[model samples]
Target: MKHLASNLYYLRTRNGYTQEELANHLFLTHQTISNHETGKTEPDFSIIQKYADFYHISAEDLLLNDLSKKEKNSRIIFDSVIFDKRDKVFIIISGTKGTYSYKNIKKCEILNEKARYKGKEEPFTHQVVTGVDWLVQANILEQPFYVGLRLTMKDGTHLAIYTSKQPTRTQTDFHIRDVKEAEKIKELIDKIIMKYKNDESYKMDNVNSKNIFFDKDRQTFQILSGSKGIYPMKDVCKCQIVFEDAKYYGKTKPFSHRLLISSFESFFVTLRDTYVGLEIELKNKEKLYVYVSNIKQKHHSDAFKADVKVAETLKKYFKTIITGNKTMKDE
Candidate 1:
């Protein structure tokens, strides 16, 4: 670790490898390499050996001696043993590593380049197409084809890697054509998300209004004081939020058809901007709407634009959650 950083940097430049090029050779991300070169972070012992192996040097020399000077006694070290036992998966975007765990993937989007062009029926009208749609449209105005992968990790790392010469909306490029491969990976990740979504103990808890949340593992949906039901995720057709009244559940009881709604006290009123309305539509065309909870807000104060962000996130979360569950049943 003493001369490791400087030595790596020196050897990479001596071998005419840019940080990214060296990173590719090492099967690591450019950021990780940059951190190592700049002494901001250290690599694992196994990773250090990879660097040594790449440059045909010993790890001891790589970490202790200054390679820029004459190395009269240095010898190469080679080991073929595999040590790590954990079952892991890795995707090389270009040459950088896309480290992911099934449980840690938040979103996997296959980004096929989008284009807008004049329609056949109306030259003055514009139509938009995405992904492989251009293969069918075959319009002259179609832009150069580009397809890429975008994934958001649970740790907040958003990675976008492209197989084409150009990226979708980011700069991570591989200059290789692997659009089909990207689509397959996205499908695999979607399954991972679905599998985790149904965990009985998995709950967003404070992330959204708890007045309505599903116990996915048990296939149960609950409400604060309105009504509760146990139905499979496949039965959920849709859901909506009502942000108009504070005591919306009291004013308009939801899902009272067969649910046992309990009489509960009302505290504060909810507003359109503040959010609290949760309406779930079942496959049978029945709807259930209610305010989040009487005392859902942590503080009683004037509503700000930022105050609504959490609710907005919850709305998106529910949409994807239900959509994922619905697709599983359909398949």
Candidate 2:
């Protein structure tokens, strides 16, 4: 046992392997390697052979030889195997093939296959860490392109990795092993990015009122009670946008259309199904719901509808704010 333990540590360090790298090489966990090196656990005979093979030596030689003699003279090898894995920031990005780490990535760039840009031309670029918003893996209907995963920044910058192509199939390859894994990776990355957004303190000019707007103009369309005031887009948080049936089961209430902001209580937006809206939660736990009205439509007789111009104006403002502040905090 002592011989095996000592040899494990000696061989690992002699090969210049971190616990993680060693685990990857042996198809084992880091904790497993740590345990073996510390003499806290033992590997089966099969695992012994695997490690022996990885080191390009016979199992008998590995178990019998006194490795200390070689350890004294052996030089550590810091080869590309360990460095290659370390260099990547993401093991997978939004359900894609390659691992992308933030290590040396200067910026995220967008690519359009259908665009008639000049040869070898790419679209906009955003800083890899701070400028990226959350990782997105969604399917858009009737679109010529299939974006496997997208990184949308707070400022509306986007970087998308294309999904696998199935010429006969109309949809993107959502079932690929790597694509599925990338979806899970996207969730993890988003949670991490959201953590940074939540950590930072962003103050709103006023939290007393929840106003809904449509276009870029700062117009107040609909205002809810108990709000501090209308907060700018940067102060918004993740919110649930719910669209209810106007006449579900049978007749419905006047304000059947609703938008729920989790961060704010007693505050929501009443909108027609076609209305545009924005919901945000700030670091301080305040929530806002903004509804941009449809110019062509009107609210039910009993319900109130925001002004058409106001709706369009607020909509534009929210879109800009959401895009500009997609992921405000640094990665």
Candidate 3:
């Protein structure tokens, strides 16, 4: 295995940074940086974080084993094996999803037809399927498709196969089918967006009461209760708007919704300039709210104002907004 220390040394050297220069940037001693690069010592977690932050790279990339030379050498050998038994195996697997059964069928029937159609001689070796089955059952090979299989050789060479007379047809068929299906899904999504835009329940009865609206067609869940004004189903993160003219927004990353809720909590503490309690409801169920005491002080009010300013700064990054209050439940 290629060593990470060597890779780190190479990266630092390629960047033209001396050990002392790197150490100064990471807040470490020059000796420590040298030791890490020479494999004499490993850096601690804190130091690792500093190194990652300095490089703007994920820690996993820095810590993983280096295989650059080995990969290059293997690729050259695998490429030159013009009529190797493994090449035929790759041809069979690449035509189908990585599945042992499908590969067997293709090698027996499909391979002959493909060879004749292409005017190429029959591949010299064909019994490699037994070896492939053994490798798969031993857990050395990962099966990624029911009709296709991805084979990873011991040397790290990889091949894929799909089970079709015209293997390339699989991708084309999938794309055409997806386009047809998306049209149907889009119709249902449009209804949801319409509901949210028309829903009366989402309208603010009292600005103090927090509310959440769900648009099923659009697959959007919107929360509208605060001075920041109508935040569209897409803006909040829990949901997204896929169709351009839908009633409710659609759902995307759930973590973004949680992040928005956290932002709201911060908004309540800072922007409203009041210590009054705030409650959050999802799907008509009371989920979360916060109560803060000591609303009388000028400093406390200023803190709330500061919180709003912070929220406004962050708000620039998110642009989607809720335009109308239509409820999905009603539709």
Task: Give RMSD to native, each candidate.
Answer: 18.6, 21.7, 20.8
Which has the greatest TM-score?
1
Q: For model 3, where is the 10-residue window of minimal lDDT?
A: 79-88
- What's the count of clashing pairs in each model shown? 3, 36, 39
Per-residue lDDT tens digits for candidate 1, residues 1-331, read: 7888998887665444678877776789999999999999999999998887665456888998877664422211111111110111233333123333445567877654432321122221232244365545434443444455556777976555444444232222332335555655566557756666564233466455455666643445665545564455555667754443333434445423222112342343221223344567777887655445444332234443334455565566566657655544443
Candidate 1 displacement at residue 164 in angstroms: 40
Candidate 2 lDDT at 22 equals: 78
- Encode model 2's per-residue lDDT on 7-30: one tens digit a residue: 988767654467897798678999
Q: Which run of 10 residues does model 2 get worst, by summed lDDT?
A: 79-88
Q: For candidate 3, lDDT tens digit of each residue in 1-331? A: 1366776686565344678877777778899888888888987777766765554344665677463342333221211011111111111212321212111221111111222222122221121222336355223432221122233333434333323223122224642343343333334334533433344334333222233444433434344422223322432322221111011112322122221222335544333323322232333342332222223222235654443343332222222222322222122
User: What TM-score fits each model?
Assistant: 0.31, 0.23, 0.24
lDDT of 3 at 140: 47
Please tell me which predicted candidate would have the highest lDDT against the true structure: 1
For candidate 1, the TM-score is: 0.31
Cα deviation of 322, candidate 3, in Å = 24
Model 2: how far residue 281 lies from native, Å: 84
Over 4 Å off, model 1: 1-206, 246-251, 254-275, 293-307
Question: Could you arrange the candidates by TM-score from highest to lowest?
Answer: 1, 3, 2
